[model samples]
Target: MRLSEYQVRFRTRDLLAISGPDDFILGEGRAVDSSRMFEPDVSPYCFDLANRSLVCVSTADISGATFFYQAQRQYARTVIKVPFESLPDGPASPALIFSIGRCGSTLLVRTLEAAGMRAVSEPDFYRQAACHRPLDISL
Candidate 1:
């Protein structure tokens, strides 16, 4: 489909949730409104850096016990693409959590959510970024 067909108005929060450059693009995406982008079910799947656009996908309500990546692959239907420049500026810094394998990271995230805090589990973009980063960097 044509890129123009997927154009939509992106709110500041939506843009913030999709922050950072995407490592790759997911073809021509589907268009959705701002509210859809606000739901946890809808995620920023990737970016079309060449076109300066952000791609988002719908995976239904994933706030329960569903695995994030599994939900994306299984239920993803609608996708949206918006101009990167149209996104408003967000906070200068972001809160992040890091941990090693089997370190209760998931439990901690759930705990934070239970406490009424917003926390994103494993997001695919982070994995993509890690894969695309230069391997020659010195520690």
Candidate 2:
């Protein structure tokens, strides 16, 4: 899909769109997730102002866009699945809110999300990282 001008602007301001090591894991199809590999250096979410959605584009793509280099996403690119072991540990959150059931934690997260912060509510990665284990497809 051709990126809109607004999307370009959003990407320009995205803190996570930086060139570095392989911090992403390509899934079965077109899905990909940031492993928080470059923790504390960059965030994992790209705040899309136009769509109000969080999107993750490859760092190479961001580089291309920044430097005016032409590299199409649909071209013959190496899509690699970064191993879980390669992912670096995420940084400790500066602020964490704990609560019982039906608490406002979700609201807080959503509010942060709306303000262009990379906030997640009860992310599965927390459990996976806590156990120091990768995900099992069978489970």
Candidate 3:
């Protein structure tokens, strides 16, 4: 099938580029609009970095849009496509990993990210954490 002129032109750059509807859009009312607008949308863009074309479609209503890798149009990679439906009713908090100063915590987190895990590196821990860094670890 053929694509519309707009689709050919403003198919969107990428989710990383879009960040959110707060950024500029390229269409109109009942379409990509003004107003730092954020809404449900179906955007298709090619991912040069991942070396795969992708499609992303979602909204804050049912859920926010997500990048469906052309390789796997079923789930998201970097971030959740939609906000969590609900907090777990049970008391099963996630495990925590605390690293000491300059202990290669970022390297560990980067490795996890490369393995497709949602990870973050917090260098401001010294001022952020309430407890003192433990002095030792077995391994």
Best by TM-score: 1
Writing each residue's lDDT as its tens digit, candidate 3 over 11-117 gives 33343332232122333222322211122343322221122112233322212222222211222221112111211143478646877748887577768768877
Better of 1 and 2 by TM-score: 1
Across 83-116, the per-residue lDDT of candidate 1 in tens digits comes to 7655547689978777775878789879998999
Q: Total clashing residue pairs per candidate? A: 1, 0, 1
Evaluate all candidate structures by whole-model CA lDDT and list the values in order: 0.55, 0.34, 0.31
TM-scores, all models, native as reference: 0.63, 0.31, 0.27
Q: How accurate is candidate 1 locally (lDDT)?
A: 0.55
List model 2 lDDT by residue over 1-139, tens digit each.
Answer: 1221111212122222332122233443432344432323222232222233233233332321221111212221223223334345556866665555476765776677688786545432233234433244432
Q: Identify the candidate with maximal lDDT.
A: 1
Record all residue pairs in model 2 with backbone atoms less than 3 Å apart, i.e. clashing: none
How high a TM-score does candidate 3 get? 0.27
- The reply for model 2, stretches above 4 Å from the true place, is 1-81, 88-95, 128-139
RMSD of 3: 16.2
